[model samples]
Target: MRVVILCGGESSERDVSLASGRSVAGALLDRGHEVVLVDPAAAVPVLAGPLRPGDAIDGFAVGKEPPSPAARQQLRRRMHAALTGGPVLELLREAELVFLALHGGWGEDGHVQALLEMAGVRFTGAGSAACAAAWHKGRAQAVLGATGVPVAERVLWGPTANGVPEAVRRLLTAGPVVVKPVADGSSVSVHYVDSLPQLTQLAAEMRSGEVELMVEPFLSGREFTVAVVGDQVLPVVEIELTTSVFDYTSKYQPGAVSEVCPAPVPDAFAARLQELALRAHHALGFGGDAYSRTDFRCDASGEPRCIEVNALPGLTATSLLPRAATGADWSYPELIQRLMDLSTR
Candidate 1:
């Protein structure tokens, strides 16, 4: 199979995406598949053919902070005219499938998926509308809640939001709350706030930005994630955080976070998490080879609550989905093959 893995776009998660791309490309190459790894934002190929293991795997690091906005803006400037035509499109049309390793920005928000659909190219992960639903934290929660999945009480705060302070106060009444951009991934700009004054100040700071933010009660029990791949639910992964918040730094850096796959839980509890994960996956309209990871955190009551579904999850060496796959007895290369089979079926 010929695979064109797209990565490193004009997104804040560009670093993460590039890491994922490297991992995916290496695995696919090992599996004896013809692989062409490309960063859509690059004018010339980031790496050309005669692809070797180290060539595609080199570079692309995940820092404690995401790429700066100014950096992303410059990349976007260079990318705007490149993605529409020429070699990138030719690669998309020539490959058996385009595996999107992109996260955040236009990549995860349905724009890239829509473009692929228009070009008659099949890509992995959910369709455009499902991607849109999963990209917005508020919308994902709404879809999950309506499907009877438990979700934390939240208040949306943005530039246009009125009575923001009072709404935030309502969430704070429940206890410490999580404040984050409604659209980001990899925990960028995500914070834990336990005081109204702090929350208010942070809100003001975030409000000054263009993206919408939201405040939701922080669940204290434990953190876990479940992945759905081609109608199958993989093992549960429990995230043990050294800090109260699993911010960008803790998530990407080593040792700060510990993940236990098939998360040491009673069968009943694992079943519950898997069910919630699957329901969230379906509620977001994901199917076929469209894979997703539904994040979970239990409340004080010990009941698991749905966080957000990641339609285009990270596939880096430290990514949660791959770890869960390992727990399910699938090797890294086997996981890639499984995704390829399901995605290109």
Candidate 2:
């Protein structure tokens, strides 16, 4: 199979996407598939052919903070230049399937998927509609809640929506809360705010920006994630963070957190997690055969609560999906092969 692994967009998760692209491309190559690694934002191929064992590869590193507004503006300018200058569309059309190693921004938000759909190109993971539905945290939660899945109570605010003051008022009356960007992954811009002052400050910062943000009452419990692939639910993954929030560092940097696959929980509890994960996946209109990861958090009562569903989950070595796959007795290469086969089929 000829696989073109797309990665490194102008999204905040560009670094993580690059890492995922490298890992997926290498695994597909090992499985005897023809793989081309491309960074669509830059409109350049990182690799023209399959990788050989012991071959050194250029690696992308993740920073602790997301790119600033100015930097992101610059990235958009470069992206526009590349899209106009490079043959990205032609290359994508030629591939048997595109493994979407890209995350966040246009990649995960349904824009890229729409283009691929228009071109009649096969791609891994969910389709455009599903991606769009799941990319917005509030909308995803609403869909899941409507389908009988338990999701945390959240307050959404943004430029178009003037709910920030209400959110802050609620925080003042309640207590500490969890704040995060509405459409980001890898826990970028996720934070735990403790007091009214913090909430007010954060809200002010967001009001001055163009990003939509969501806040939910902090649930004091363990965090877990479940991966769904081809109608089957993989093992649950538990995240243990050393800090208050699972920020960029805790997510990508080594030793910043500890992850356990097939999370240490009772069979019934794990089964429930898997069930809800599948439900969330379907509720968001994701294909039953597509691959996605649904995050969850157990409240003080130990009941699982849905967070958000990721359509194009990261495929890096330490990514939760791969960890869950490993727990299900699938190697990295085998997992990559299975996802590719699903897309082609």
Candidate 3:
């Protein structure tokens, strides 16, 4: 099958995206498929590498810069041009399927899915609405909470709202709260506050924008991630961060953390976590043939609380999803092929 793996974006996860693209492309090539790796942030360029029976083509570089008004506009222009231009659109027309590996912002938040839908292109992962719902932590939490899924008690704080005082009250009641940006990913602007005084100071230091914030009681338990492919759950991977919490730096940097695949949890608890992960995925309208990584916090009672779901998780060699897949006896190349086949189906 001729596949196009879209990766790299203007989000803070650009580096992560590139790593994912490389791994995916290599895997596809190893599986005897024609592959094109494109960076949606840059202009589509001709991809060339040694051609073999299972060799993949890494093409296209989409330009991306730091998150800024000007940078966003530039990225939009580039995407519009790429999708409407000769090489990218032509490739889409010829390719059998698209393997979307892009992370954060427009990539993971449904913008790219909408574009692919408009172009009548079949791509991997959840559709636009699901992507949008999952990308916004507050909205996803609302949906999960309504369904009786255990989530951290959270209050949304806006820039111009008097919610701060009420939020402080909640923090006082639920000490050790985590403050996170509602729309951001990769833990950008996520901070742990041990007290109301620290929360107040942190809120004051936060940039005044229309961006919403979420204050939730910090769960004191182990952090585990469940990777789901189709209806099958790979394995639970425990994330051990060197820092106080798993922030952006700890996420991408190698050796900053260690992931124990299968999570060293009991079989019953692991099964429960997998069940909840599938529930969270389907509840968010991600029932299609795609992959997602659901995070959880297991308390002393051995119950897991859903944290957040990554619709498009990192595919780096050491990424949680791939790590779990590897533990399931699926090599990197085999995993990529499985993803491609699933997308096409």
Candidate 4:
């Protein structure tokens, strides 16, 4: 089968997406499938023609900091023009299937998926509707919560925070609160703020014409995540945070946080995590053949609340979903193959 692996978009998680694309491309190539790696955010030589059987693509290691908002916007404009008038479209047209290794921004927010669907192509991961709902953490959690899944309550601040002071004041009544971007991944710009002064200060610092934030009561207990592919629920992966919050820096920084797969929890706790993960995945309308990862954090009473679901979870080396798959005895290549088989089914 011919596969076009799309990655490295103009999002905060661009590097991580590139790393995922490289991993998938290599694995499929190793398994004797023709693969073409394309980075819509930049120029890649392979996009000049049809899918090729062998192409050694590398040097896409993740960076510590994501591109600034200004930079990302600029890149997005440039990339949009390039994709509309470049050979990348040609490759997309010729490929038998497209594997989306993208995360965050339009890639994971339904824009790209809708475009692909309109073009009549089969792709890996969830459909456009699912991606849109999953990208917005607050909306996704609300859908899950409405379906009887417990979730952390959140107050959103749209493109421009309408009432920052009011939101902060309300969230402070519940002790501490966590602030995060409304539609981003990899925990970028996430803050666990305790006092009103601190939260106000953070809000003031981030206050801009395009700031999208959401605040929720902080859950101090353990943080857990699990992946679901089709009907298979992978093992639980526990996150051990090193700081007040698992911000983007801590998430990608080595030794910043330890991730334990098949988490050292009791049998019942593990089972609960698995059950909730799958529930959150399906509650968000993700298809069975697609894959997703759901996150949760326990409250003071040790009861877990669903946080959010990731439609296109990372496939990087240190990513939690892949680690869970490894704990389930699925090698990296086998997991990739299984996803491909399921996605094209």
Candidate 5:
């Protein structure tokens, strides 16, 4: 199959996306498929044919801070122009299938997926609507909650803090809470706060438009993620981060955390996690062999609470989804091929 692996974009997760694209390209090539790696941000594909395991992979360094709003807007415009005109777009339309190795920004938020669909191209992962629902954390949780899935108590706050619901404000005062960007992944701006002062500061930051956030009572227990491919749920992967929170560094950097697959939990508890993951996936309208990764944190009573769903889950060598697939005894190449087969089905 001729595949174009779309990777880096203007999002804060661009580096992560590039790494995933590089690793995926190498895997596909090893399986004897024609591959082209493209970074729409660069207005062209790598054109190097296929990457080898030992090849050098280059991308921007991820910092603790995110890109400024102005910078993001500029990059979006550049990427839009690049995608609409040139050989890269041509290749995407011509390819047998396009593997979406993208992580954040317009790439994972459904904008790019919609465009590809309009161009009559088949791509890996969920469709546009499902991607949109999964990209927005608050929306995804609402959809899942409506379906009777176990979701954490959360309050959505937009730019200004004045309009916050009184009930939500009360919930914030009762216990430790988590504040994070509703539209981002890779734990970009996630913060765990237990004090009034910290909540005030985070709210102020949100009002400044630095970030839009959702607050959820911090669940003090184990964290596990389950991956769903087509209708099959893979094994659970328990995340043990070095820090109190799984921030950007702990997620992408090696040795920052230890991930255990087939998470050493009771069979019943593992089955529950898998069931909730599939429920969340289908609730968001992801169907026909679509893939997703759902995160969970066990509550005090040992019940798992759904955190969020990642439609375009990372495919980096060390990403969670691949680890779960590996736990199910599927090799990395086989995993990539499975995704390709599902996308083209």
Candidate 6:
């Protein structure tokens, strides 16, 4: 099979996407598939041949300042030319499938999937509507709650004046709260506010964006995540971060957080967690052939309350999906193959 692994999008998750792409490419190659690793931002001139291991290309650098408008336009033209204007299009046209290893923004939020769908290309992961719903924390929570899934009590802080203070009051009424942007992942902008003063300070500091903030009661318990692929739930993973909370650093930094696979919870509790995760996934309109991850926090009483559902979960080497898949005895290649197969069906 020929596979095009799309990675390194113009998102905060670009670095993580590159790491995931490297792993996905390696796994696909190991399975005897021809792979083309494309970083859309770094579209370069015609290559002598397909990129080989350690091959370098110019016009792009990850985690750096993005190119100016004109530079970006040129890069886009080159990428479109390379992928759709010449032999590169022919090459991609021959691909058996496109494995989207990109995260955040247009990649994970359904924009790219819509483009590929219009091109009649079969790709992996959820559709645009599901992606959009799940990516927005407040919206997804409402959908999940309607399906009887237990989500944390939350109030959304929209762009209107008085929204922030109202949300803060509601959350503080319940106790310490976690405030985060409504449409963010990787725990970015997530903060724990223990009092009204802290909440007000954080809210004031976060007032510059159109992105709404979400204020929810902090769940005091063990943090766990469940990965679902085509209705099958992988083992639950418990996250134990060295920091007080699992922020962005804890997520991407190796060893910053410890993941206990097949979490030490009882079988019944684990089963319940998987059930809730699947419910949340389906409630968000994720049908068969899509993969999703649902995060939860189990109180001391063993009741697991849903946090959020990642429609497009992180696929980097250290990501939870792969770790859960590994616990299920599925190698990286097998997992990737399975995901592709599921998506194309």
User: Clashes in each model (backbone N, CA, C under 3 Å)?
Assistant: 0, 0, 5, 0, 0, 0
**Pairs of residues at least 3 apart in sequence or in different chains that clash in candidate 2:** none
Candidate 3 lDDT (Cα, whole model)? 0.77
Q: TM-scores of the models, in the given order?
A: 0.95, 0.93, 0.89, 0.94, 0.93, 0.86
Q: Write the per-residue lDDT of candidate 1 for residues 39-133, one digit (tens) a residue.
A: 87866754545464444456467877787888888778766655677777888888888888888888899988998899999888788999998
lDDT score, candidate 6, position 277: 89
TM-score of 4: 0.94
lDDT of 6: 0.76
Tell me how candidate 2 scores on lDDT.
0.82
Q: Which residue pairs clash within candidate 5? A: none
lDDT tens digits, residue span 263-321, model 4: 99999999988988888888888878789998889999999998888888888877877
Best by TM-score: 1
Q: Is candidate 3 or 4 superior in TM-score? A: 4
Candidate 2 residue lDDT tens string, 270-328: 99999999888888887855889998887888877898899999888778899999999
> Which ranges in model 2 have alpha carbons more than 4 Å from their true place?
43-56, 78-86, 160-164
Q: How far is candidate 3 from the true structure (C-alpha RMSD, Å)?
A: 3.2
Inter-residue clash pairs, candidate 1: none
Per-residue lDDT tens digits of candidate 3, residues 127-225?
898899899999999999887778877788878875366755766575677888888777767888886677777787673656678877777778999
Q: Name model 1 segments beyond 4 Å from true.
A: 43-45, 50-56
Positional deviation of residue 83's Cα in model 6 after best superposition, in angstroms: 9.0
